[model samples]
Target: MRIALSSYRSKPHSGGQGIYVRHLSRELAALGHDVTVFSGPPYPELDDARLVAGRATDRATGPASRQTSSAKRAGATASIEPMSIEPTSIERASVEPPNPGRLRLEKLASLDLYNDDDPFRHPDPRELRDRIDVVEYAGMLSGSFPEPRTFGMRLAREMRSRSREFDVLHDNQTLAPGLLDIARGGLPVVTTIHHPISADRRLEIEAATNPWRKYTKWRWYSFVPMQARVARASSRIITVSETSRDDIVREFGVDPERISIIPVGVDVETFTPDAGVAKNAPGIAVETSAPGVDVETFWPDGSARHRVPGRLTTITSANVPLKGLSVLIDALAFLPQDAWRELVVVGTPNRAVETQLEALGLSPRVRFVSGISDDDLAGLLASAAVHVVPSLYEGFSLPAVEAMACGTPVVATRVGALPQLVHGTDGETSAVTGSAGRVPAAHGGSAGPRAHATGEADTSADADGSDAGILVEPGDAHALAGGIVSLLESEETRTRFGRVGRRRAVTTYSWRAVAEATAAVYTEEIARC
Candidate 1:
């Protein structure tokens, strides 16, 4: 089947959405389907060999000036070489060559409104040169994210003229009016809502102290209403977890029957444990607000516990209130100075977080690191005594799962799919079932009841009495601190949990299985069409 997959923004390092597009497209192509990913900058980083081959072909066949223009636009130098190909059989002379089974990535150029140095800030002239669409640029200038709506417009316009080119159109959460336009034109459409954008808007509103900031957040999330409309109208909806599915239903008013749940998968190969790699000092690794790991402010006061050298790492992409970084920092205050040696955060912190760290006098104990490669991350995870995810809510916590895949124990909040993923159970009867006091349920209501009837709860704990990870109440710094302290204090428990987590990651979360299940959904949707 020929499939057109769309994502407004799909930079691999940008977030989970990019990772989803890259892995899923590769797996679908492996399944003998023609997969074309329509994305925006920064484009998905595909295999260098495939990209080089494609670019070489394009350059060799096009005019020299055209080649130069393409190379300049792509921000890369292009070199071309011709290779001879021999026909396998004389019979092939009379028939057309079959299409190669490889994933194709096409990035739709747009004004990259966000700066690399400061993503939320407006871009300078150098950044503006790459942007092509005028309407998209205007949206960005107007202080609203225009990618989803604008990408949908471009995709719809492109597909309307060539609608017959694809067997199915899969949208990666860009629920824009253009999607509804395509669906109305008799094309099969599937939109994956990782979670409702409404949840994000609400979180941002709650996080805002100033009335103007809250209003600004509201304006930024104004695209959500259009998303809800498109979601309800799509032929089918896919979500990462039951927690997110329920939130979608509540926030978007979509029928429960239309949404299907498919948990995200981790690349076990890339994230596997490396015992051969030396572990960092006995400290924890903290995911910072930045994309890479920054380790500047880790040394605490003159003491032996601080000198013993262990790190506590927290990985967070955004330093927002919903991430609970402040709560984690607050939790550190409750712990004894000797409880943990140093805190290593993967991303940079926001101003609010910085203030909290300063107020608590814990700035000396925290080190922030960013821009580290995935292999380096795996090594970091393996080195850490424990991995911590302090998010108040998540559609699905990829970091927690990735940490587990690296044979590292995780301590995360019981929100979204964290419990189900960490416990290695289905959504219905996971370890943390009840909604009360668990980070104010995603949509302000109980997640209804377990869809599937089960007699007993599946224990995440192994026979050795170690759980894959512990689930704590969201926003409860005390509980979070205690969980981390407990895990840090016991090597036996930590080792057992790590073993169980690694096994769960390997067996239950393979991309091949996820792709097959996703294909089944596609088949069903196509049949309905």
Candidate 2:
């Protein structure tokens, strides 16, 4: 089957979209189908249809053709263990390489106004040669996100004249009217909405202090209504979590039957347990700068048999209010000064975060990293004391799963998919009602945490009622602090959670499983088309 995957922007180092496109395409190709990924600026570093490095005119190519010699295609079952904090791999079951699938990426050009090197960029007048280019610029000037709509237009134009080169069109959340145009030309379109942009808009608007800020937030998310319309019109939709599916039904008014619930996966290959971190010294991990380049990070681990003490890690593609970075900062402030030594954020730090850190005298403790290599990220997760996801909302929290895959326990807000991904105490999660519901602060050298509801396990990864991590009420700084403090204080609890989390991550969320399920969607959609 020939699959054409579309994404407006895929930045592999940071965003989930990039990671989604890269890994899913790879696994799909490994299943012996042909995949051609069409993407705009901040292009994806795909293992499937990958962008050619530093080439003006290199043809897109897939790994199977370049790498596979013989053997039938392997089945998409079992764990995709070890993750690079975001994505990684697992060993494929040795089987015949059926059909020998191929995956390659085709680049799509865009003005790229939001490039970090320069934001709100001024394009050359001559560059605005096409009507589409002018429209993209006009949208940006009006304070609206123009990438999705413009990129869809560009994609439609690219495919307009080409004889149906694909069996199905897989759209990665770029809900645009142009998709309707493509559908008119006889291509089955399958849309994946991680969560609605409306959710983000609501959070930002509510967080805004002034009328002007709220108005700006409204303007920025102006495309959301259009997205909802497109989603309603869409024949088939894919979402990551039950919460997301529910939101789509309530927010977009789309039929529940049109939506399929497929959870996001973690790469077990890049994010595995830290076996190499020698316990020669307490709270020490052999960090690597590159291959054969070792950098050592030492923290005071009193009884932590697994992780560095006071090293908390979190990842966010963007520094938005919805991510709850502010709450995480507040939580840190609530902690005793000696409780935590450092924080490692796996994303860029903006002015807002910097200002908050400075105001709280935490300027010297927090370390922000962007454009980190996969290995480095995995190593960092493995060494960290606790991985935190303090988001007020998440369609699906990828970082939490990735951290779990790295054998790192997570302390996340009890919202979105965190409850499903990270099992709290008592087999299933129960929301916090009041102060009594909050997780109590546990010291760093405490005993085992939570009950072990071990029974006959099911296929749904870590079905045993062992707690993977503690889930706190959303937007509560004190609760966040308590959860983190609890894990930090007890290595026995951390070790248990880490193992259980790993089991859950591996058995439940694997790229191979995701690709196979996605392919099934494509097949069903194409049949309808």
Assess every candidate by TM-score. Answer: 0.78, 0.80
Stretches of model 1 off by over 4 angstroms after superposition: 48-100, 117-134, 275-309, 426-466
Number of the top-ranking candidate, with TM-score as the measure: 2
Q: Which candidate gets the maximum lDDT versus the true structure?
A: 2
lDDT tens digits, residues 1-529, model 2? 9998889987655568877887787778777888777888766544422211212222222221111000011111122222122121111111112346666557777888999789989899988868988999998999998899998898888779752888989999999998988988999999999999899999999988999999999999999999999999999998887678878999999998788877777777657886324334343343221234333354334322356678998876778888998889888998888989778776667777888987887767776655444545666688788999989888878888878888898887767777767763342322221211121111111112322122111112244556678777678788788888878878887888888888777776787778777888888888888
Compared with the true structure, all predictions reach lDDT values of: 0.65, 0.70
Among all windows of 10 consecutive residues in model 1, the one with the lowest summed lDDT is 66-75
lDDT of 1 by residue, 1-529 (tens): 8888889876555457767876677667666777877876655543322322243422221112211010111111244322222332100101111335455666566665664656755445555542336667777667778889888887787788877888889999899998888887877898898898888789889988899999889888888998988888777888877788888989999998887777777768656766214334433344443333454422222111221235676777666677778878887887778868777677777777777777787777776666555545565566677788888789987788788888888877778888766655532222222211011223221212311122112223444443577767777777778778877777777778888788878876766667777777888888898
Query: Could you tell me how far off, in angstroms, the CA of residue 416 lies in candidate 2 after the best superposition?
Result: 0.8
